[model samples]
Target chain A: SQQGEEDPQALSIQEGENATMNCSYKTSINNLQWYRQNSGRGLVHLILIRSNEREKHSGRLRVTLDTSKKSSSLLITASRAADTASYFCATDHDYKLSFGAGTTVTVRA
Target chain B: GAGVSQSPSNKVTEKGKDVELRCDPISGHTALYWYRQSLGQGLEFLIYFQGNSAPDKSGLPSDRFSAERTGGSVSTLTIQRTQQEDSAVYLCASSLEASSYNEQFFGPGTRLTVL
Candidate 1:
């Protein structure tokens, strides 16, 4: 069974708009990480938020983690067509990281 | 430094034939992991290796799937009697340590197609 599940399986927005994706997990975790995958390619690491932290930022990406709710959200600001990709959330537990089904976001021109 | 790397970025094999996939982790990384991703599906844990400790084969779906890590550096995943369901991208990852907070760096992946 998978440890994490992502909501809004797919999303589409204009290039300049912002996009938000959510992830929920079932167990305790030490950290939650986000990854992006282009069509027909492997995943690329994005950002990681520790269980002890509430939010972290890097460039146009922002991630927030709420351990109490066992959920996390990723926000991509001022998106671009190049931002089009499938996003996944992974939770680290007991030394192994389990990934979610993922959210596919399309940034239209 | 170079990141984790996987060989034969793409492989196509006929059904019933055997296939071997290889992965080379980053230098000095002790933790190696293998995962399978089917089309539109999440990553499924396949196996894990840390240093010289016994590799974790618990996630293997069947007896036909096996993997090994030699010298605690390079790892190989072998599938015997390939099946259509076995077609997927095989990903390899390695971390500096197995600590809960350590992030895993992924390889480009070996795309395996079982006809």
Candidate 2:
């Protein structure tokens, strides 16, 4: 069974708008990581947040994790056409990664 | 000199044929992983290799799916007697270590279509 599940199967917004995606997991994890995939290509690692950390920032990307809720959210501020892709949240448990179904984001320029 | 790489960027094979996908990890990476992603589905773990230790093949869905890492650098995934249901993108990733905090760098992936 998949450990992580993302809400909002698809999202659309204008280039400069903010986009947020949420992921919920079923088990305890050591860390949560976010990735971006373009078309049929492999996923690119975006950011990773440890369970002890509540929030992390990279460039315009912000990620928040709530262990109590077993959930995490990835926020992309001032989105760009280049940011249009499928975003997935992966949970690390016992050295293995379980990914969510992912949220497809479309940024109209 | 850059990042993880996979060969045969695209593969199309008829049903009942066999296919092989290759992956090359970054230098000094100790942890390698293989995953499969079908249309409208998330990435599914297939296998994991760590150093000289035995690989973790627990994620393999069936006996037809097998993988091997030689010299602890290049890895190959072979599917025998492929079926149409095996059509998907095969992804390979490598990390600095097996630790939970280490980020995995992924290859472009090998898209397989079994007709």
Candidate 3:
């Protein structure tokens, strides 16, 4: 399977704290993407970082990619209760994405 | 603009029965994909369609799984003679094209329960 793996299967942080998730994948990829799922519902695209990109930022979300190690990390700064969800990292190759087992985040109100 | 849409948000069927899940892509998008997610698991690609070209079914797990896209817009996934293991959330996504750089827009998935 081309599917990747995400570490720290679960996380709990204060509403104002930060949450970070790491992902590692096998095989070459053109890009990697982060998605957020609320209560097992549909996934919302969070960010996409290409293989050549080392870091990218959007709002409170920061993503870093290290193609040399075939790994990436997502940082949600100053997370809120609304940020509680499952985060998944997918490797994009051949126009398809192999998703990783997500990291479930729980934010304390 | 409206995002992707799916029908029959939840379904429960017998192991020997069949089920169909539908997906509607964003307007003018040329790429559609089908995926399945077992409880507490990650997404598994089932098939992919680019415009009117033949779909890539390399990810389909068994012969009981099949899908079809009509007019490059809407798609349907059919599971025949389903087994208890077939229970999962079927998700659909659409992108502007088949490029790896494109971000896909997902639809609320259809939850299938095989009893």
The lDDT per prediction is 0.91, 0.93, 0.93
The TM-scores of all predictions, comma-separated, are 0.95, 0.97, 0.97
Candidate 1 Cα errors over 4 Å, as ranges: none
After TM-score superposition, the amount by which residue B77's alpha carbon in candidate 3 deviates from its true location, in angstroms, is 0.7
Scored against the true structure, residue B1 in model 3 reaches a CA lDDT of 95
Assess candidate 3 and give its TM-score to the true structure.
0.97
Worst 10 residues of 2 chain A by lDDT: A1-10
Q: Write candidate 1's Cα lDDT for B10-97 as tens digits.
A: 9999999999999999999999999989875669888899888888887899999999998889999999999999999999999998
Q: What does fnat come to for each candidate?
A: 0.64, 0.85, 0.77
On residues A39-89, what C-alpha lDDT tens digit does candidate 3 reach at each position?
A: 898999999999889999999999999988999999999999999999999
Question: Per lDDT, what order, best first?
Answer: 2, 3, 1
lDDT of 2 at B76: 97
| Top model number, DockQ | 2
The alpha-carbon lDDT assigned to residue A77 of candidate 3 equals: 99
Q: After superposing candidate 2 on the true structure, give the runs of residues whose Cα lies further than 4 Å from its correct spot.
A: none
Candidate 2 lDDT over residue span A1-109, tens digit each = 5789998899999999999999999999989999999985978999999989999999999999999999999999999999999999999987789999999999999
Best by lDDT: 2
Which residue pairs of candidate 3 clash?
none
